[model samples]
Target: MSHKGCCYDNAVSESFFSSLKRELLIDTSQHSAQQAKTAIFEYIEIFYNKQRRHSTINYCIPELFDSSFS
Candidate 1:
């Protein structure tokens, strides 16, 4: 948690949501809550964490980056 009124506290979360909105959610049409949840889960677990390369980590997949730390 961050101190009240601190914008930087949510910057990383905001960036992630922005990417989610632009990448997966934008192209998808979910007719039910379950569908939306499933799509979000797959997007984060499969695509975002495993397949997608992040520039911040020198274009490496997030799962690989995390495994390196572990």
Candidate 2:
């Protein structure tokens, strides 16, 4: 957890939402709740986790980074 009212504490989450807006929601504003949920799930699981290279982890796919610990 982080101190209350500290934006830095939430920087990672904020960055993610910013990316989601730019990459996924820029043109669309409306969707059924179920559709929105499914889209987010696919974005995070299929694209973000599996394919997006994260700079914070030395430009590695998250799954690759995670497997190094096992």
Candidate 3:
């Protein structure tokens, strides 16, 4: 858990949610809760984890980073 008022402790999570809002949520409207849930799932599993390049990982996709350990 992050310490109270320590922004650095939550920087990674903050960055992720910021990207999610910017990339997927802004200007898009979902018809239902389930629809929003599905969209978020796809964004995380298919795009964010499998396709998007993260600078912290030297611009490698998260799937590639995981595979390197196998």
Candidate 4:
């Protein structure tokens, strides 16, 4: 969390949700809560965190970008 009344507090989260809606939820429909949970988990862990290239990190996979620091 950031300081009170900070405008940038939700910037990262908002961007992430926007991408998630556009990339994963636009075409897919989940029948149940469990199914939605599973789909979101896979989208984040398998695709977003691993396979997708992020422009913010020089078009690198987020996992790879994190690994480079270690």
- In terms of lDDT, the best-performing candidate is 3
Provide the clashing-pair count of each candidate structure: 0, 0, 0, 0
What RMSD value applies to candidate 2? 3.0
Which digits, one per residue and each the tens of the lDDT, describe model 4 over residues 1-70?
5797564888888889889999999889999999999999999999998999998999998888999999
Q: Estimate each model's TM-score.
A: 0.77, 0.69, 0.77, 0.77
Q: Please give the lDDT score at residue 20 for candidate 3.
A: 99
Better of 2 and 3 by lDDT: 3
- Which residues of candidate 1, in runs, are more than 4 Å off? 1-6, 63-70
**lDDT, candidate 1, 1-70, per-residue tens:** 7789686888888889989999989899999999999999999998987889998999998888989998
Candidate 2 lDDT trough over 10 residues, lowest sum: 22-31
**All candidates: CA RMSD (Å):** 3.0, 3.0, 2.6, 3.3
Q: Quote the lDDT for 49 in model 3.
A: 84
The total of clashing pairs for model 2 equals 0
The TM-score of candidate 1 is 0.77
lDDT of 2 by residue, 29-49 (tens): 656988888888888889988
lDDT of 3 at 52: 99
Local accuracy by lDDT, each model? 0.91, 0.86, 0.92, 0.91
* Higher-ranked by lDDT: 3 or 4: 3
Candidate 3 lDDT: 0.92
